[model samples]
Target: MLEVADIFRAHGPTWRRTVSLSLGQLKVMSAIEQCRSAALGGHVLRCSGCARTEIAYNSCRNRHCPKCQGSAARRWLEARQADLLPVGYYHVVFTLPAAISAIAWHNKTVIYGLLFDIAAQTLRTIAADPRHLGAQIGATLVLHTWGSALTHHPHVHGIVPGGGLSSGGERWIACRPGFFLPVRVLSRLFRRRFLEALTDAHRRGQLQFFGEHAALADRATFAQWLAPLRTCEWFVYAKRPFAGPQAVLAYLSRYTHRVAISNQRLLAFDERGVTFRWKDYRATGRTRYKTMTLQASEFMRRFLLHVLPAGFHRIRHYGLLANPVRRDNLAKVRDLLHVAPRFDPPSDDTVIQAQPVFICRHCGAPMIVIDIVARTAPIRAPPMSRGAT
Candidate 1:
C-alpha cells in the first residue's frame, strides 16, 4: 500500500528545487512528508493486556493532507449530524463551462466566490418564484475544483431540502416526492447570475488574466470571450432524493472533506514516476478504470492545482441554513413540521476514563499512554530487535 507521504518524502525535495510553489503548497507538502513520522514527535502506547509496546507518531492534521483527514472528517460529520432535516434531501450540482475554467484557475478567489454566491442565489430565487417551488429553500454547497483525471473542473455540490418555507413563513411547502426544482430552470438562472457576477467583477478590476487570456484584461475582449457561454446550456443536475437524513449525512461525510486524490489510489513510485488509478466517466467497464503514470513533478503540479486561495471557504450554507439565522430557522421549520428537538444530552456527573488513541496490533488490547513526549526531546524509538507480540 503506497502512501502519499512516501511519494513526498522520496521526491518532494527534488520537486521543490525544480518548480516554484505557493506558501500553502509548500506547507501542505511539508505537512504530508512529516505526518505520522518521528519528526513531528509522538507518545509511546503500552498495551494493558499483552504488555506490548509501540511508538505512535503524531499526524500533521493538515486539511489538505490525505493521511490526516479521517479524524477531521469524523469530527465535522458529527457536528453536522444535528443539522440534518427529517425530509427528502436532493443533490444538486452546478458546473462551470470550460471557457470559464481557465479564468477561474488564475483568479480563483474572485471567480470561486462568485461561483458560490451566484449558485446559491439561483437556487433561492428560483425556489421563491411562484412558477417553481414557490418557497424559500436551504442548501449546503460544497466546492470541488478537480475532476477524476485531475483536471481543473469547477463544480458545486448542493445538498438541498426537497421543500422550503413559504414567503409568509406560515407553512412548509413541499415539492413533489423524488423531484425538486427543474434542472433547466436552475441551469439557466445559474448561467445568467454567474455571468452577471463575473462581468461585474471584471468591470471593477477584480479579475486578473495572464498568458493567452491576457487579452481578456480588455473589457471588449472579455465580453467577446463570455458571449458564447451566455446561451450555452450550463450543466445543472439534480440527483434522486436521499433515502433519509442518515443517507444525507453519509453522503456529506464522503464529499465534504475530499481532496483531489487519496492515498489509497496511489499504486507505486519509481524512477519512471508515480503510478495512480483514475476513473474515466466517458468510458465503461474495465476501460473506465485504468492507471496512469506521470513524472513525479507533473503529479505534484496537478495536485497543487487545487490548493484553494488562502482563507477561501470551500463549504457554505445558504437560504434557511445560512449561518446568521440557522438556529432560529431550523427551530421554526421543525416546529412547522412537528419534529421534536434533537440535541446533545447534558453531561453526567460520572467521571469518564480517558481512551487510548491506538490499540495493540497483536492482541487488540487497549494501549495506554505510559509517557509524554516533547518535540524538542530525542525521538523515543521502540527496541529494534523486539519480537512480534
Candidate 2:
C-alpha cells in the first residue's frame, strides 16, 4: 500500500526548500519519513523455538501519522472501557464556518481552544436547562481539522451518553427515547457563544492574521467580518443513538485517532501525481466515492496542514467526563442506573499473564531482544567480544 510516509520521503526534501513551514510541520514530515525505517533505531529479535531472527524498527508514534494511530487508538479505548455507561450514546458534531476556519489557519492554538471550550459549554448549558433534559451531561470531544478531501475543515466530534445525573445527583435523567437535544438549539447556542468568545479573543489580541486576513487586526473590521456568521446557521447535528455500548466503542475507535488520510485509501503514486480515494460528501449514492489526484507537493502540504501546535490536545473531556472528577462521576452515574461497575478489583490470588511485545513470524514462539541498533547506524552484525573464540 502507498503510505503518506512514502510521499513525504520522496518529495519532502525538495518541498522543504520550496515552501515556508512551521517548526511543528517540519518535525511531522521528518518523523513520518523516517518511521519504521533504518533512519530510526531498531532491535534484533531471536525466536526461542526456532533460529529465526528479525529486525523491528521503531514507529514514529506521531499522532498525525497514518500508520501510528491504530495502536494509539486501541490503547486509549482500553483506558476508557471502564467509563462506558449502559445507556445509549449520541454522536454530535460542531463545525466552524469557512470564515472562522480561514482565521484559524493563522491562530490555531487560540481559535482551536475556543472551539473546544465553546462547544462543550453549549452542550452542557442546553442539557442542563430545566426545559430540556434538566441534568448535567458529560462528553468526550475529539477535534478533527480536515475534511474527507483533506480540505481545512475544523470540527469536533462529541460522544455523549443519552442522559445525565439530576441536579441533586440522586437520580438519572434520560433524554426522550431516540432523541438528544434539538440540533437547532445546539447550533444557535454554539454560534452565539463562539462568536462572543471570538470577539473577546480579538479584544485581548489573542488572535493573529496574515495575507488577506491582515485587515482583521482592526477591531471594526473583525467585528464586521463576524456579523454575517451570527445570523447564519452553524452546522451542528446529532446522529442516531448508538445501538449499544459495544457499538459506541467501535465508533470511537475509528474516529478518535484518525489522521487526515489513511494508507488504505491510496490507489497509486506516480509521475501523474498521487492518486487516492476521497468521499465527495455533497454527492449521494455510489457517486460519493471518488478518486482524486494531487501533485505530491500539494499532498504533503495538505497533510502537514493538520499537524497541531505543540502541547495542544485534540482530545478532551468535559463536564462529568472531565479528568479531575471522572472516576467519582462515573461511580455516581453507574449507581443511579443500577448497572454493575465495568471493572472489579482483581484478587491477590489471581495470576495475570502479560502479552509479549514481539512474537516471531517464522515460529509461533516469543521473540527475545538480542541486539539494539542505533539510529542512522548501519544494520550489520554486532562486533564480537574480546574472548569469544
Candidate 3:
C-alpha cells in the first residue's frame, strides 16, 4: 500500500521548485504531517485485560487533511440523519461552460458563490412555475473543485427531493414518478441564470481577470465572449434517482467530507513525480484505471487551488432544508411519511466524554502506550500492542 509520505518522498522536492505555497496550504501540509503523533502531545493507553500498549496523539482536525475526513464524515452524517425525508431523492449536477471556468478559476470566491446562488434560484423558480411541477423544492448543494484526475473542475452536486410543496401549500406535488426535474430545462435555465449573475457582477466591477482573463476585463470583449454562450448548450446531468433514503444519505456522506483525493487511490510514487491511478471516463471497464504522472509542483499547485475562502461553506441548504425551517420541515416530513415521533433520550451521566481507542485490527485486543516519543529526539520504538490484533 502506498502512503502520502511515499509520494512526497518521491517527488516533494521537485514540486517545491515551481509550486508556489500559500501560507495557508503550507500550514495545512505541516499540520497533516504532524497530526496524531508524538510531535504534539500524546497519551498512553494500557489494556486492562492484558499488558497491551498503544500511543495516541492529538489529531490536527484540519478539514483539508485526508486522515481527518473520515471521522468528520461520520459526524456530519449523524447530523444529517434527522434531515432525511422518507422519499426518493435525486442527484443532479450543474456545471459551467469552459469559457466561464477560466474566470471562475481566477475569482473563485465570487464566481463559486454565484454558481450556487444562481443554480439554487433557477431550480426554485422553475419548480414553482405552475406550468412546471409548481412545488417548493428543497435541496442541498455540495461544491466539488476537482476532477477524478485532480484537475480543476468546479461543479455543484445537488440532492433534491423528488417532489415539493405546491404553490398553494395545500398538497404535495410529485414530479414525473421517478424523475425530479427535467434535465434539458435545467441546463438552459442554469446557463441563463449563471450568465445573468456573471453579467451583473461584471457590471458592478465585482469580477477580476488576470493573465488569460486580461482580454475579458474589457467590457466589449467580455460581452462578445458571453454573447456566444447565450445560445450554447450547458452541461447539466441528472443521475438516476436514489434507490431510497439510506442511499441518498450514503451518497451525500461521500461528497460532504471529500477532499481532492483519497489515500486508497494513490498507487505509487518515484523521482519522476507522483504516479496515481485515475479513472478515465472515456474508457470502459478494464482500461479505466489509468496512471498519470505530474510534476510535483504542479500537483501541489492543483491541490492548493481548491482551498476555499475561510468561512465559505462548501455545503449549503435551500428551501425546506434551509436552517430557519429545517426543524419544522423535518417534523412535517416525518409525519407525512408515517414515521414514529422522534424520541429524546436523557443524557448519559456516567459515560466518559472522550477516550482514545486504539485496538488491534486482527484480534480485537486493546493497545497500551508504554513509551512516549518526542519530535526532537528519536529513540527505540515500543513493542507492538498485545498480539497487535
Best by lDDT: 2
Writing each residue's lDDT as its tens digit, candidate 1 over 1-389 gives 78877877787776676665777787777778777777788888899999998888888887788887778889899888878778999999999999999889889999889889999999999999998799998999999999987889999999999999999999999999888999998999899989998999999999889998999999999999899999899999999999998899889988998998998888889999899999998899989998999988888889889989779999999999999988889889999999976765447985778666677899988898888665543222221233423
The whole-model lDDT of each prediction reads 0.86, 0.90, 0.76
C-alpha RMSD of each candidate structure in angstroms: 6.4, 6.4, 7.2
- Compared with the true structure, model 1 gives a TM-score of 0.92
| Candidate 2: regions farther than 4 A off | 377-389
Better of 1 and 3 by TM-score: 1
Cα-based TM-score, every candidate = 0.92, 0.95, 0.87
Number of the top-ranking candidate, with TM-score as the measure: 2
Instruction: Provide backbone clash counts, one per model.
Output: 0, 0, 12
Query: 153-195, model 3: which lDDT tens digit per residue?
Result: 8899999988887665556777887776778988988888888
Pick out the ten consecutive residues of candidate 2 with the lowest summed lDDT: 377-386
> Model 2, 91-201: lDDT tens per residue?
999999998998898899998999999999999999999898999999999999999889999999999999999989999999999999999999999999999999999
